[model samples]
Structure formats: structure tokens, C-alpha cells
Target chain A: MEKRVTFRGWMLPLLLILPQVVISAVFFFYPAGQAIWQSLFIQDPFGLSARFVGIDNFTFLLSDPFYRASFVTTAVFSVLVTLCSMVPALFLAVLADRLIKGSGVYRTLLIWPYAVAPAVAGVLWLFMFNTRVGIISWYLGTLGYDWNYVLNGGEAMGLVVVASSWGRISYNFLFFFAALQAVPRSVIEAAAIDGARFWRRFFTIVLPLLSPTTFFLLVVNVVYAFFETFGVIHTITAGGPQQSTTILVYKVYADGFVGQDLGSSSAQSVILLLVVGLLTVIQFKFIEKRVHY
Target chain B: MRKSLIGALLASATVLSPLAAYAETEVQFWHAFTGRLGELVKAQVEEFNNSQSDYVVVESHKGNYSETLNAGIAGFRAREQPHILMVFEVGTATMMSAKGATKPVYEVMAESGATFDPNAYIGSVKGYYTSTDGEMLSLPFNSSTPVLWVNRDAFEAAGVDPDTDLSTWQKVGETLTALKAGGEECPLVTAWQSWIHLENFSAYHDVPFASKHNGFAGLDTELMLNGEAQVKHLSAMGEWARDGKFIYTGRRNEGGANFRSGECALFTESSAGYAGIKAEAEFDFDVRPLPYWDGVGNAPQNTIIGGASLWVLEGHDAEEYKGVGEFLAYLSSSDVQAKWHQDTGYLPITAEAGEATRAAGFYDENPGTDIAVIQMTAKEPTANSKGLRLGSFDQIRGIIDEELEAIWAGDKSAQEAMDSAKERGDTLLRRFETANN
Candidate 1:
């Protein structure tokens, strides 16, 4: 049966949704439309003059090797960030779920990192891992291990991934903790009574029940790693050490703001928008099928 | 009726007050200075405001150089730009090509009927912000050039002569080898790697960094920095890096921290690095001319300026223009320019200001401070060594930085990195040409 709330006057329904429609149109549609429009033109840095060159920016970006390399960098970065953030968050959630007292204190302590801004978090990590004056770097040096991320591509990528994932673990932990608490005690007890071990019980009953949460988090974490790690990469590496860490979003900022190549930046943004859209569609289409609820 | 009568009386009294006699026109001046520089700029503004009764100049710090330029552009797009914008030297070409967006300083001075003389400015400094006919387009402010900053105590500790001659690259190399042999961890480090090591390297060697008179003659310039001279110099630096004689710090000025802490024996940085070094370093240091390769023809021609200048944005009212012109004239005055040079270690843009500083014995009191001025004004700038005026220069600099980093990391040879950088940078240049031309 289909149930609907009907408004007698058409004006009331229109008025009820006017704010959301206006917000979406103004903030989302308008700027996206502008990017699409601007991507078709090449303009001076100051916008004093603009020439219409339809499809040229997109074609140029597609043919550029650096832009293509950024795609691979983004992929590796997103996968690493998702795994690093979610695995520790799940372990912490499981540990907190087993606690009987002071769980609130543990949860509060774990949730504090999310309060720090991404750029600030990156700076904190950078200070600790700085090649010249960092305490950690000094310690590593004493251990006969030279740690200089400024020139090392692999180390630079690792530093950014660790910094980015460190900030995101708190958000993932909160959701995972909530989902774990909601798992029924009786189901676990019944499995225990049937002589199943703790690990077996968890794998059979609790883990299956948490599949829906896991799937949701996977999608959310992928998106978070994709769109929100720009500040981390910017403050830490700045897409250097031979462009090893120049992700898609960071490239947009470096090209648009730093380079002042607006057309290429807009084209890059359009491509990133399509990429996120496509990923979301794929996640909903295939990955959600295996989710329990 | 009583209340209305009271209101009318109050309005009349407000209009008749003595404080309302002169309505001072406000001139908005946005700059990119912070810390010590910021305080000095504020003092200058306060002096100007106190010296006048008809104009109030409101100065604001608008982030760092690139951020300030972006903010100015965004403000212009919103029709809320300040009357005066301080742009870094790299943004000269962008500002020049922004045709209707800015009113040239020469036009502003003439239209406001202010006493103006273009020849008062030092030629090499003014050449950066001028037209082909030698007309001043922007007022050069806070100009600086690259120089070698040597830690004398470090050199002495390393058993190298503190007064060793380092005018040529070969001499510097020998000094670095000696410093390394004497247990110095970092013999040499550089800031603005691409700027000091390549761009200025080309200019100082009197080689073309880019074609078309380094982009001054036309918009069709492409990078020519991968030539034999540049390759030889960069290869030497690369070899130094492999032997731990040269430290590879982060791209911009991060090496300053090491140098100031006395970890590095020599630093190639801006002449303006004096202020920071003086404030931070506990050891004796000296400023010297940037080293050149003896093999290159007539090496050490001149190193170009790297600081910023003041550009007058268009669409301002006539009265504001008058205030801007007056402020610029006041800023270019000999006393103010001399004090700025003495306090900040920037080159005095005006020849008169330089003379005044010399007369006051500022250079003699602060030994080695005059090296930058002498390096710039020693020879008339040639077409190859004047300065680069290419569009999309900031982006090209980034490409060059990446390539240089690759070379430093031993990922690529100097020739390979430079070739790649030139190819990548040329694409941006071509795009800039198409967009602007």
C-alpha cells in the first residue's frame, strides 16, 4: 500500500520544499553549472579576456601524462586511507564493545582526534616527522635509519596517508561502536551456549549482522579519502617528490589556485565530479547487494 | 511634535559640528607583508596618515604573496578591489596582461598631476615592472636579489679560510669539499632552488632562460633553460648532493631553518634573508655575491630581482587616484626608501635613496649589505639578462621545482630533468599565449 501526505493547497507543498530546492540549486547546481560552462573556455588569470574553446581543455587533460598519473595516485591513496582508517576503527569498536565499565571514557578519548582540522592534523604529523628538526626523525637517525620525507617519494606518501587516516579514524569509530552496541546479546549468548568459541560466534552471527554497517562505512570512507584528503596532502607533501602524491583533488587546487590555470582546473573538477558520481553509482549497484540489511 | 523638533535640532547640530569639516577620502592599500615586514608597513602607513589631513590610507595584510594575488583577483571579480595591490615579481606578466584591470602607475601619476620622475628608480629594478618603451608600469617596492649567505664561524670551524674567495662556482666547490672533509654535515643548502639555481643562474651567466628576449619582446617565448651551461652547473650540484656536500631541503626557504641554526655552512638565498638571519643566527655571517661559473661567458652579468611591487588597480575614483599618487610619491621619497633599505635589507629602488643610504654610511656599518645593490647595478642589463616576462610563470616555476627535486633525489639526471621541465613548461606557455594573445 502506498501512503502519502496530501496537502490540499498546492502552495503549501511548494512552500514546504522551497528552502531545500533553493539551497541545492544555489550551492550545488549553480557552481557546478559554472564549472561546466567555464571548462569550455580559456581565460586569462585575471579574467580580463576569455576565448571559447569548446572541449579543448578536456582533451588536453586526457592527453596529459601528469593528469593520468594523478588518477593512479588518487586510487592508491584512497584505498590506503580507507583500509588504514577503518581497520583500526573496527578494532577499537570491538574492544570498546567488550568493555563493561569506563567505556564512555575510552570512547571520548578515542573520539577527540576528529575535532582537529585536517590541515592542522597534517601539520602535527609533519612537525613530528620533519626531516630536519623533528624529534621522531632525530630518534630514527640515532637508530641508523635516515628519515627524510621531503626527498623520498615513498616516505612522503606514507606520511600523508598516516596523517590523513589518523584524523578520519575517530569518525569511523563512532559509527562502528554504535553498530556493535546494537548487536543483540541473546544471539551471542545462544551461540556461546551451543559451544561455539568467541571468535567463531563473532564470525558467524555478529559479523554478518554488521555487514550493512561495514558496507555503508566502506562507501563513506572511500568518498572521505577521495574528497577530504586534499588539506592533508597539501600541508604535508604538496604533491611533490616527483608528483608521487598529487591526488585528484590536490591537483585541482594546485592547478586552479596555485597555477591559476582555471580552464584546466575546471575540466579536472568536472572529471572528478563524474568520477565520484560513477563510484557512488557502482557502490549502490553492486556492493550494496551483499549487504545484509 | 516635541520629539520631531528634537530630532531636527539634533540633525542640524550634527551637520554643524567642527569635526565634520574635512571628509577624508580613504585609500585602501592591501599588501602581503607579515611579522617584522608587516609592522614596518604599518608604521609607514601610520606616518603617511599622520602627515596628511585629506586622505586616510587604510593598510591591510592579505596573506602571503600568492594568496594576496588570488584575493585581489577575487575581490576584483566581486567589484570590491582595493585601490592599491602589492603583487610579487612573478605576477608582473599576469598584471601587465590584465589590460583594463589596472591603471599604469605612469598614467596615475600624470593624471593626478603629482611630481613624478621615472628615471629616479634604479634601472635593473625598474626594468622588471616597465613597458617596452621604458615606462614605469608599477612602483617597484621591496625588491631583492639572490645572494650567497656564508656562515663564517662554520667556515672557521671547518678549517676553511673565513675570507675565502667564493666569486666563482669552482671556488665554492673547493670550499664545499674542504667543509665536508672537516666534518661539516651540510656544506651548502639553497632556498628557491629553481629561482636561485636555474633562472638567476642563466641570467647571471648572460644566457637566455627563455626565447624572445626572455619573453620581453613577444608572447611566443618558450623555455631555453636546458642549454649546456645550465646542465653543467646543475650536474655539479647533483654530484655535490651525492657526496653529502649539498643538503636537499624542501623547495622554498625551509633550508633557512637549517642555515640559521648553524647546521649549514653556506646558503644561497635572497638578500632579504638578512633580516631573518640577523634575528635568528648566533654566529657570524657574511653576505656575498651569487656565485657564477667561470666557464660561462662573461659570467656574473647580473642577478634579477625577486621581491614585489605596488600596482594600482583600475575602476577607482579620481580622488582615490590622487591619494594613491601621493602615497606612492611619499613611499618613493628618499628618507622612507633609505630607512626601508636600512631596516629591511631590501634594495633601495631609487638611485637617490641608494645614494642617501650610502651617504649615511648604512652599508659601511653593516658590512656585506651592499653586495646585492652592486650585483644588480654593476652592469646594464642585456636583453638575455634583464628578466623573464613570460606568462604562466608561477606554474612554470612549479614544473621546474618538481624537475629540480627529481634531480636532487637522484631520480633523473640534470639533462633529463631539465629537458622534461622545458617540455612541460612549454605546454603551459603555449596555453598562456593562446589564452592571452
Candidate 2:
């Protein structure tokens, strides 16, 4: 009788959550479900008649080399960009903790690029990498490296990684800094008293305490690397110099918006959704429990 | 003298005039033109608004061609679409096939009883915008063909003759080598890779950009970009890229900055690049016909257009429709078209407007603005020379951009790149076919 009353007590809260759940269903689940439905059917620009073809779209995409290559490119790009951005961001956050003065100023300066719009960021980087009049290109040329992202695939990828990481550092740093701030001062002092040197304290105590934020940011950074960096690539490289940077999101945009192939583009989107969704679930399941807090 | 009566009449007339001016319906126009061209379009709208009382034209910049197209789509979905949309050449089929969604320009003109003659438009410019039965669908606003922009100052600095016959790609390649070898870094570059390289390449050689009347006749068109000649040209371009003779920029007018900055000696860019070039270039520059590949069959047949045209969207009230008609009529007027052509370096939509521009001697004074018109209308466009009409062409261009980039970066050979582009592009083609058929 006590257990039944406890279950009944919580019933109203779940009922109140119904509207929010329905709204999420409509906005999120419906579009995702519709995308999957559309992927299985062929569609014209007119949104006219569609014929359902069972698994044909998936089969066709799997056989296509371009789609396969884009998947690989996206994976490689996401991993590299995440690793580059997250590691440096943590380092900066830890360093910021050690600052005796002007830490607030340093924090403010680090978060500046986060305010720039994605398209504007792309245009800025595009101008900087421009071969003719770009300041970066001019300086590089003076040092004799040519610095043409258009001609060199490796350099194009490198530039993309740099531009993507530069903007991403702000986001990661914000989260890591907040986490670092919340770490108890007494625990850190205790570790120091125990003769845990600076590096040792950071690796064992501070890093373990920051694990929750790190894991959270890792998932977010992965998602960002997959989706957000496409804009930079779209603006900077456009998967060029021999398609060195044709990631999944870029391909989806190219296929859907530019090609106007709604069916195939939809198919590509759904495939991307599945891949990203699986990766996200795996990340949460494996990493979320490692957080002590 | 009836002074009291005269004073009362004058006071009443002043109030009436202001109301009459504000009574005109407002028509909204969304377009992709900006910079010098944006100013020119704004001027045209202001002039039209000033000259008219029935409708006031309000023009808004909706980003570049692709962004504008996307914005229109989103707006239409939200039922907030503008009356007129400036869609690029490749988006023609997408807009055309959107049934019950667009108001054909012919119907709009007829409804307004405006004097519109389809025959007045240049054949090459008008053909792409017309239907199978020859009905005008959209009003061609800014029509331009690809041409080679030679920075004569850069040429002089590099000690190469600016006017020496740059008629063939082989010659341009040699000249580019000479310039680069003489210490010029950005010797040659181009904008709109797919349009200039693949689309115009096919047209120049009197070959097809696609099959089945370039998809105008049907939806089952397959890409022919993987053909032998195209591969050969791409391979050569790849070689130039490796040798640092040709500077590869991002697709979609990335090299425009290079050409305008006078960093590159020769640039293959849309003729419409003229407005920006004229405005910004600190060096002497001239537009010439796009160079041909000597090995390709019948090189330099003609170049394809790379500008946008105004299309009327459906689902507006009668008053809005009238406003759209009046605004389109205002845009098509000889004076308006002529001024637009002169100001923006876009071709005049009508022959009379072209003649009006020439009579004013603008082309003669400008030196190379007329080259686009002359090259495009040099002869009647063969079926191959007529513009491509494939659905989802924008996406295909993206795929082409990807493959071409690969070829340029030396990761994929030209033949391999072309093959991948064709195969990838065809998957889209088949899907478009299955859907549209």
C-alpha cells in the first residue's frame, strides 16, 4: 500500500510532462521520421507523386564510392578537429586557473570567436586564406611556402582543422573553465599538502574532477565537429583541391540543396542521422558513467 | 480675380496629391545582386518608383544566388514568399517544374495588358527561360556569358603581350607558364569552375552538357562530363595546379577577388564580373572570348549564361499580381533595361534595349562589355549550345566541384575524377527521373 501511494504521488509530474513530450515528438521526432520516410521514396521538386522503394536508396548509396568516401572523410575530420580543439581547450582552462591576475580578461578574449556567425566566420577565414591579398598568405609567401590551400590537399585539410579548432576553442574553453572553477579549493590544497606536485595534481585530482565536463564536451564537440565544421569547409575549401574535405554534412547540403535531388538528399540525411545517433548513444553509454559527480 | 476660390482649390489639391502617391501598391523583390550591382539594382528600383504611381517596387538583397534561392524556398514553405525571386540559370528547371507554384511571365504580362514581345529578347538568353511551346516563363534580368578577363597591367609587368591571341587554352597555358616562370605567382585563375569548365566546355565544343536536350526535353538526362575531351582538359588543368601555374580557389566565384586584386594576369570569370572588376580593379583589364581547347572539336562555339532571371511566384492576391506585373513591365522597359545593362554589365534583355545601349555608345566606350552579347548571339545556338535544363543542377555542380577539386589536388586523376562525378551525378539524375517522371 505504501509502494502504490509512492507511485501514485509521482504520476502527476509525468502527466504534466506529456505536453513537452508531444511537442518534442512533433518538432524533432516527426521531422526525423519524415526524413526517413522520404529517404525510402523517390521525390521530385514538385513534391508530387512518390513511389516507395524498399532499401533501394540505402543499397544504392552503399555502392556509391562518393558517399563512402564522404563518410570516411567526416569521421577523420571530426576526430582530428575534436582532438585538436578539446586538448588545447583543457590546457588553456587549466592554465587560466593558475593565473594570479587578469584571468577574467583572458577568459573574455578566449570566448570572442564564439560570438561570430558561422557564415561570417567562413568569410573571414576565406579572406585570410585567399592567395592574392590575404595577410596570412602574404606572410607565408614572404617566408617562401606558397601557402595555397587550393592546390594542396594536405594543406587544405590542415587549414580547415586550424580554422575549425580556432573557433571551437572558445566553446570548449567556456565549459572547461566553468568546470575548473567549480573544483573544490580544499581538495586541491589537500592534494598539494600530500606532496602531489603541480602536474601530478592536475592529472590525478583535477582531471578526474573535470571528467564530467570533459565527457559532456566530448559528445558536444563530436556533434559540432560533424555538423558545424561543414560550414567552415563549405566556406573555406568547399571539399575541393580534389575533394579532400567533402565531409558528410557538406555532401548532404551539396546533394540536397544544390543537386535538388530531394529523394537522394533525404536518403543521405537519414544515413547521417543514423550514424551520428549511433555514435552519440555509444559515447553516452561508455563515457557518461565515468563521471564521479 | 476669385482669390478666395483659388486659395481653397490650391489647399485641397496639395492634400490629394500626397494621398495619390501613397495609394500605389508595394511589390517586394528579393535578389542576389550586391556590391556595385546591388547599387545599380537599387537605383533602377528607385527610378521606377519615382516614375510610377500604380506600384512602388521594393528590392531586398537576399544574399548570393544559392542563398537567395534557399531563402525563397523557406519563405514559400512559410507562406511569406516575395512576389518576384531572382533565380540563377541552373535553378530554372527547379522553379519551372514547381507546378501551381510560379506565375508564368507571359500570363502576368497579358493580364496587365503590358506590351511584351518574346521575339524582342536575344535568342540565347530567352531560350533557356521559355517552355517547349515557346512561352516566356521568367524575365531575364542579368544574363552573362563566361569570358577571359586579362589584366593588361599584370601582363605588361610580366612582359607578356596582353593582346597576343589568347584564343586557345593551349596558348593560355603556355602564356601562364611564361608569366609564372617570370616570377608572377597567380598567373591564371578562374571563377565558377563547373560552369566555365564543364558546362561551357561542352557548349564550346558543340557537345552536350547533358542528354535529352540537356534535360529540357525530359528528366532522364545523364551527365556527359566524363567524356574523353573533358577529362583531357581537366587533366591539363590539374597539371597546371600542380605546377602552381593555375591558382585554384573555392568554387563559386572564389577567384573573383584574385582577378579584382590584380594578382592574376588572366582570369576566366563570368561576364557579369565586369561590374565588380570595373569598380575595384586598380589596373587595366579587358574581357575576351573564353579560350578554346584546340584538340576539342569545334572549340569556342559559344559560352553559356551565368546570371539570374526574375520569376513570379504564385498564390498572391489579384492586387499583388497586378503589382508584380507592373514591376516586371517597369523592369523590361527599354530605358530601364538599357540603364541596368550599362550599370551592372548584365546583358539587356531586349534587342531594343541593347540597341539603345549601343546608340548611347556605352559598349564602345567600355571596350569589353559587349563581348558577352556578341559571343552569345554570334550565331543561333545549336541544341548543344542552348543552356542546360537539368533538375538538381546546383547539387550536380557541387559534386563536380568536389571531383574537380580532387583532380586539382592530385588525389584523383582527371579521368578518375570525371568518372566519379558522372557516376555520382547520375545517382541524382536517376532519383530526379524516378521522382519527376
Candidate 3:
């Protein structure tokens, strides 16, 4: 039996959701519609003149090898950022969960990186890894290993991925730690009495209970890696060393704002929108089935 | 005739002071200068304001060059553009293509009845921001050209001559070898590699960087940067990069820090590198002319300029434009121009300003301060040596940077890289042609 709070009239429900609908329309839907419309035209930097090219921008983008390469780069960056951020975060969360002494302090310390902006995190990593003047690269030079990401494509990609994931790990740690605390104590206690080891009981019982949080984080972090890591990529590599580190969002900024190619940039964003939407749909359709919640 | 009339009104209005002038026209100026340069620009605006009671010029420091141009365009779209916007050299083509967005400087000067002499400008710098018929479209505010920056301390430390004659690329290669063998980590590092290496390289060697008189002749121009001269030079640089003589730095001026810190022996950077090197270098430094290939006929052609210029935007009234014209006259005055050129290492745009700076002994006091000016005016510019006027050049430069990086990384040969760059750049040029046409 469930208690239902049915709306007495349609007006109240509409009024309750009005603010949300308005915000989404203004911030999300309107801009998305504008991007789609703008994609069909070519214009100078000034909007005084515009030509209706009608899908030429999209055709150009799809035909560009560099643009196609960026799709692969974005996918690789998203996966690397997700795995690198999540594993260490889960480990830290599990370690903090076991702490009986000063657990709050440990948890607070673990969550501090989330407060840092993505660009700042990138600069910090850049300072340590800069080829000529960086402390870490200087030490590596003393050991006789050449470290110049400015020329090496693989090194540039590796550096941007690490820099992008640095702040995201702190965010995932917060969610994972909160979920770890909410696990039922009775279940762990009962498992301990069944001659099961701590590792086995934790994996089989506690980890299964944290599925909903994990699934949610997976969705959020994948979206974050796709869109929100532009700052880190820009500050660290600027999609350079032969465009090896050029993620999709960074290309959007580079083409649209920096290059002033608005039509092609809008076409790129529409493609990115479809990509993320399809990724979300796939995740919800398949991955959600495995989640107990 | 109209220009002279506005010039007369400006003089009479000033002479009459508060009685004759009913209103002080407000003129807005947007620029992309910051730090010491930003303060200097603010001071110039203040001086202009203080010098006149008939007009007031308000100067705002927009973000960087790209941001300032975008802001001007966005403002134009909103019908709120500044009276004048400072645009970088790469954006000249885009500015020219958008016919209604700008008010040509010659027209502004003519219509406002302001006193302006087009012949007063240096040919190379003036040629960059002009129409095909030699109509000045923008005022050349702060022009700079590429020069070889040498860190004397690093050179001496590597057992090389601090005053080596680096007149030709052949000589530079010999010095680079000596510096590397003497245990220099960075024998040669450059800022704005594409500018110093390829674009200016083509100009200095009197080779076309693009077809159609380097795109000044027509919109159908294709990149000629993949020609024999350019490929040969890039190949030599690529060989140096392979031998650890030419250390590749980050794309922009990130190498400025390495050079300033005495980590690099030889730096190929803008002559305006003077501003930073003067303030920051703990080691002694010197400026030299950009090197050229030894074999080309009349090889050491002038290098092209690489700084921002002032272009008046549309949507401003005639009264405000008179203020703009008056302000431009004040800015290009000998006193102000000499001071700006002496302070920032930018070339004095006006010939009178250069002569005044020389007459005032500023050049003698500052050893290498006049190098950029001399290098720019050293020869009457040929079709190949004048300047690039390609649309979508900013994006084209990005493609060039990418391909050059591949050459430096030993992933592609110089010929292959330049060919790819030309192919990629021509595509953008075609797109710009269709869009603008």
C-alpha cells in the first residue's frame, strides 16, 4: 500500500514546476535550438551578414580527418578520466570508512581537491610537469629521462588526462564516502559471524548496496569528462602536440571562439549533443538494469 | 575637403575652449593590452583627454587580442561597438571582409575633415592594413617585427661568441652546432614559431607565402608556403631539432620565460621581446636582424609586422568620429609616438615620429631600439615581401603550427608537413572565400 498525494488541480502542479521549466527553456533548450539553427548558416564574425549554407558545415566537419580524430580522442579521454578518477576515489572512500579514529579529518582532507577549480588543478600539474622549468621534470632530467610534452603526443595526452582527473577524483570520493557510510551495519556484522573474510564480505555485501550511487556517479562523471574538462585541457595542453589531446569540447572552443568559425563550431556542438544524449540513453537502457535501486 | 573642415573645427574648438564647444563628444577605445603596456595605453588616453576639452576618449582594456576582437564584433552585433577597436595583425583580413562593421581610417579622416597624411606612414607597416588601391583602412598603432634575440650569458657559458655575426641561416646553423657541442641545453628556442620561421621566413627570402600577391590581389589565393624556399628552410630547422640544437618550446610565448631566465642561448622572437627582456633578464641580451638564406637574390628582404592596429568601428555618429580623428592625430603625434616607440620597442608608425625619436637621441641611448624600424624600412617591399592578407589566416596559422610540430617531433618530413599544411590551410581559405563572397 502506498500513500499518494494527488494534485487536486493541474494549475498547482504546473505552478510548482514552472521555475524549473523556465530555467531549462532559457538556459538549455533555447541555446540548443539556436545552435541547431546557426549550424545551417555561414557568417562572418559580425552578424551583419550571414549566408544559408544548409548542412555544408556538418558535411565539412564529418569529412575532416582532424574532426574525426577528435571523436576518438574524446572517447579515450572520457574513459581514462573516468577510470583514473573513480578507482583511487573508491579506494580512499573504503579506507576512510574503516577509520574509527579521526575519520572526519581524513574524509575532509580527501574531499578538499573538489573545491579547487579545474583550470587551477591544470596549472598546478603544469607547474610540476613543465618541460624546462618544472620541478618534477627537472628531477626526471637529473635521472637522465627526457621529458618534453610540448613535442611528444603521447606525453601530452597522458598529462591532460591526469590533470583533468585530479579534481574529479575528489568529487567522486565525496559521493562514494557518503554511500559507504549508509551501508547497513547489521549486514556486515552478520557476515562477519558467518566465517567470511572482511574483503569478501565487504565486496559481496557492502559494494552491492552502493550500486545506485556508483551508477549515478558513472553517469555524472562521464558527462563531466565529456564536457566539463575543457578548462583542464585548455590550461594544460591547449589541444596540442599534434592535436593528440584535443577533446570534443576543447575543439568547440578553439573553432568557435578562438578561430571565429561559428557555423562549424555550432555544427560540432550539435554533434556532441547527439553523442552525449545517445551515451546517456544507452547507459540508462542497459546499465540501469544491473542496479538494484 | 571635409577632413580639412573637421581639422579646422578641431583647432577652432580648442582655441575657443569652453565658449565655442557645446558638448564634449565621448569616444570609446577598446584595446587588448595588460600589465605595463595596459598602464601605458591608459596614460596615453589620459594625456589625450587632458590635452583636449572638446572631446574625451575613454579607453578600456579588453581581455587579450582574440577576446578584444570578439568583443568588438559582439558589440557591433548589439549595435554598441566602440568608436575604435584595436585588432591584432592576423585579424586584418576578417576585419576587411566585414564591410559594414568598420569605418575605414582614410574615410574617417576624410569625412571628419581631420588633417591626415597617408605618406607619413612607414610603407611595410602601412601596407598591411590597406586596401588594394593603397587606402589606409586601419591606423598602425603598435607594429613589431621578428628579430633574433640572443642571451649573451648563455652564449658565453656555452663557449660561443656573444657577438656572433648571425646574418644568414648558414651562419645561424654553424652557431647552433657550436652551442650544442659546448653543452647548451637550448641552443635555439623560439616564440611564435610559425610567425618567425615560416611567414617571416618567406618574406625575408622574397618568396610568396600565398598566391595572388600573398592574398592581397584576390580572394582566390592559395597558400604558396609549400614552395621550394620554405621547405628547404623547414628541413634545416627540422634537422636542427633532431640534433637537439633547436629545442621546441610551447606554441605561444611560453619560451619567453625560458629565454628570460637565461635557459636558451638564441631566441627567435618578436622585436617587442624588448619589453619583457629589458625588465626580466638577469643576463645581458642583444637584438639582431632576422637571418635569411644566403643564396637567394636580394635575400634579406624586410620582415613583416606582428602587432595590433586601431580600426574605427561603425555605428558611431559623425561628432564622435571627429573625436576619434582628433584622438588618432594626437596618438600619432611625434612626441607621443616617440615615447611609445622608445618605451615599448614597437616601431614608430609615422616617419616624423621616427625622425623625432632619432633627433632626440633616444635611438643612440638605446643600442638596439631602432632595429625593428630599420629592418622594416630597409628595402622597398616587393610583392613577395610586403605582407600576408589571407582570410582565415588565424586558423591557417593553427594548422601550420600543428604540421610544424609534427616535423619537430620527427614524425613527418619538412616537405610532407608543409604540403599538408598548404592543403589544410587552402580548405579554410576556400571556406572563407565562399562565406565572405
The interface RMSD values of the models, given in order, are 1.0, 2.4, 1.1
How many collisions per candidate? Answer: 0, 8, 4
Provide the clash count, candidate 3. Answer: 4
Per-residue lDDT of model 1, residues B1-437, tens digit only: 13344235433543553332347886878899999999999899889888878887777777889888887887777667778999998889989989989999999999888787888999898889999998899999899999999999999999999899999999999999999999999999999998899889999999999999999998999999999999999999999998999999987889999999999999999999999999999999998999999979579799998999999998879998999999998998888999999999999889999999999988889998999999998999998889989888888898998998888889899999999999999999899899888
- lDDT per model, in order? 0.90, 0.82, 0.89
On lDDT, the leading prediction is: 1
TM-score of 3: 0.95
Ranking by DockQ: 1, 3, 2
Clashing pairs in 3: B2-B113, B3-B113, B3-B114, B7-B113
Provide TM-scores for the models.
0.96, 0.90, 0.95
TM-score of chain A of 2: 0.91
Of the candidates numbered 1 and 2, which has the greater DockQ value? 1
- Candidates ranked, most accurate by TM-score first: 1, 3, 2
DockQ of candidate 3 is 0.68
Candidate 1 residue-wise lDDT at A183: 96
Error of 1 at A87 (Å): 0.7
lDDT per residue as tens, model 2, B134-251 = 9999999888888889999988888888887898988988998889877888888889899999998888888877888788788888888888888888889999988989888777
